[model samples]
Target: MSTPALTLHGVGKRFGDVQALHDVDVTVESGTVHCILGENGAGKSTLCNLVFGGYPPDTGRIALGGKDFRPDSPAAAMAAGVAMVHQHFSLVTTMTVAENLLLTQHGLRLRRQDLTDRLDEIAQTYRLRVDLDQQVATMPVGARQKVEIVKALLRDPSLILLDEPTGVLDPAEIDALIDTCRAIAADGKAVVLVTHKLGEVARVADAATVLRRGTVAGGGRMSTTSIAQLLTAMVGRTAADLDPTVAATIGLDPADAVTHRVGAAPTSISGPDAAEPRSITTSKTSVPMGETGSTASALTRAPIVEHGAESVAPRVDNESGSAAAVLTVDRVTVHRADGSTALNDARLVVYPGEIVGIAGVEGNGQSELVAVLAGDTPVSGGTVTLADTDITTANPATRTGLGIGIVPEDRHRDAMVAEMTLAENLFLGRLGRFRRFGLLDKQAMGRAAKAELDRFDVRAAGPWVPMGSLSGGNQQKVVLARELSAANLRCLVAAQPTRGLDIGAVDFVLTQLRRAATAGCGVLVVSSEVPELLALCDRVFVAYRGALAGPVETSDPAAAQQISELMMGVAA
Candidate 1:
């Protein structure tokens, strides 16, 4: 038999008091896509880092192509034919894509034209196109993700590790990435996909290993292992114990949601009312997985909806439409830093006690809209009002003072400082509030932060730990805890609130949003996941080409279809 592409036996890693991974065993053969599946803090990233040489294992052995492999650094790993695409990007934000790629080359004096040609060649071969001269900082999260993929591919490694690659991609982009993974494996290379998304595993993975709390819980060939088996292994719970909404969110059927047979016909998994499943496909003619059909079909479908009438959590009554609007964007127009129009004639209204959602493909003016609302970018034309007060020209600090809380999309870059402690991050913009006698009252701030962290169920060492030390989910919780705890919060603009969270974390965050709305705070969520919008929002809108579409009520049976059409610019 041919030697496996990679192997790990009894691998264990520890950091301080935390056992990140322990007694783990895995093998990846050539010409196969191996998935590392687990929830947040399940040690999936740790395992990937161990292989990519981001960190060293405290025990056991790893081999690459039948040879002992102990790479002290990422450079050594790359030299030994291992490349990695991190969940959080690793690009120099100040540089262009071409320059970033050039930095990864072996020689320091390589010509730019030769590197560009090589990048173009790899991009064409893998269908992973990226703008060569685009600044990494200016690109959207999805675009950055593509650049990362292309950068990894440029290495021409035998094994590539992708950590949560699809977390930021749209449905069409996701389909394209899956195709890319398949192509890479077909070319006799090994692919290691680290993710918590079950639908993705159903589509692209040849085999999977489930991790729970730093140990291997279950694993096998994708053809044999059932979705229920995998879910149970990851969370230590049966399908019945799983929340139906979460089950549907992650691409498992609420009833008999077990097997996701690849290439099988669409499965009509019953929704709340057991209505017939509707046929919905993405703009790329691919079906989205985990909605009402097979994983592939469900993933390709654009309109994510329940089989029957739209069922959402109980929300405060806003049907009267008589209440004064808490936030209003009237014909708002925003210009990009380059003087190009980013948002044009965009109008929206959010009343008190409502959860409003904005859904669209990335780079469709969503970021612009968020920025305008957050008071980061001034609107070139039109008025923004908070509770009948015109604040179109309000700055970020002014907006925050006016009870407008913002949870920006890029949490690490725009929301929190990684180097700061949890207590400091929790009170980042509002440090003045904790002042005593013209001095920073750090002790009081720490005590308050600890209370809020406990309230939000944030798992961390304490308020003194650096915010970067927390898991993605825990970090998000800290952000939410800080924003939602505002003394005068009236409206919240949360962008991609649940982008990379685990199932449990997703549920917690959504519940908090709902709770905030119930407490008479207007909530606006911007997300790429249509199903998430459908499940959470009372009314959903689509942002396209710097414009706003319908406020499609979630109660409408055809809401998903309408939103999908609006996103694709084909709304009737």
Candidate 2:
């Protein structure tokens, strides 16, 4: 038999007190896509980094083509025919695609024209086309991903590792990426895909390895191993043991018989006065999460059907227009620095005790709308009102003071300072509240932080630990804890709150939003995941070409089709 492209036997790694990877074993053969399946902080990324020479394994061995392999640096790994594309892109946003590609080449001097020609050839060969001269910042998420792939391809490596590459991609883009992966593997090169997305694995992977708590759980050929088996290994729980909502969210089989309680209202996860638990068999034809079609329809079907003596219905009359709105955006229009309208006459209202969702493909004015709502961008034409108080020109602090909480899309950049302690991050913008006289009351802040962390179920060493030390899920928990725990919070505008979270974390976030709504707080969620919106929101609106379309009721049988058409700008 031909030697495997790569192998890791008894590999282990550690960072500080955390054992990131332990006793892990994996093998990738040429001409195959090998998937690394795990939840966040399950050592998927750490395993890839070990192979890419980002860090040396604390123990055991890695072999390339049946030969012992050890590299001191990423450059050495590249020289040995290994390339990696990180979850967070490393491209220079200020530079053009061609310029970024050129930076990856090793030389004292090189011809830019030659590099451009080579890039064009590779693009044509792989069918991953992108404008060579377009600035990285100006390109869409899909285009930027293609650039990263092309950069990795340029190395002509024996093995290429992609870490959570579809976190931000739309459906079409995800399909395209799957095709690209097949093409790469067809060329007799090994592909290692590190992701928690089970659907992607089912579509593109030839074999998969499951990791849980930094140890090898299970793995096998895709044809023989069921997705349920893989999921069981990853989470250490069978599909039957999971809540039906969570099981569906993480792409379990539609036929799985699972039961969960329904609250007094269809809009909430569970009402504050919810009755005894009930069992209901879901539809056999229900669309699973991460599937390519009609997820909104699948999730919304029979959402609140009458069961015997219990009749689940809407308790909160948000659409009646009787209760005062917590947030109102009226004819909001925002222009980019280049004089182009980023948000065009967008208008929406979030009533107290309601959860509203904004859904669309990325770059369809969602970011601009979020910025406008966060008071980061000034609206060219609009009036934003909070509880009858007009605050169109209010700054971020003023908005926060007026009971508007924001959770930005890019958490690391816009939300929290990673280098700071968890305590500091919890009280980031509201340091004054924790101040004792003229000095900062760090002790009080730490105590409050600890309480919040425990309340939010954020798993971490301590409040004194750096915020960056926690996993993506834990970090998000901190952010949510901070925003939701605000004493004066009346409205929460969260953009992609569960963008990179695992299935468990997604459940937690959705539950938190529902609880907030139950407590009379208006919630606005912006997300690219249509199913998530349908599953959690009372009503969903699509953002299309800087315009708003449809307050489609989640219970509408045709809601998914309507949202899809609106997203494509085809709705009349």
TM-score of each: 0.86, 0.89
Cα-based RMSD of the predictions, in order?
A: 6.1, 6.5
Question: What are the runs in model 1 whose C-alpha is more than 4 Å off?
Answer: 92-99, 108-125, 129-140, 238-313, 429-444
Which residue pairs show collisions in model 2?
none
Worst 10 residues of 2 by lDDT: 260-269
Name the candidate that leads on TM-score. Answer: 2
Error of 1 at 255 (Å): 4.8
**lDDT by residue for model 1 over 339-410, one digit each (tens)?**
888888989999998888898888889898888888777788999999977888888888888899999988
- The TM-score, computed over Cα atoms with residue i paired to residue i, of candidate 1 is 0.86
lDDT of each: 0.79, 0.79
User: What does the lDDT come to for candidate 1?
Assistant: 0.79
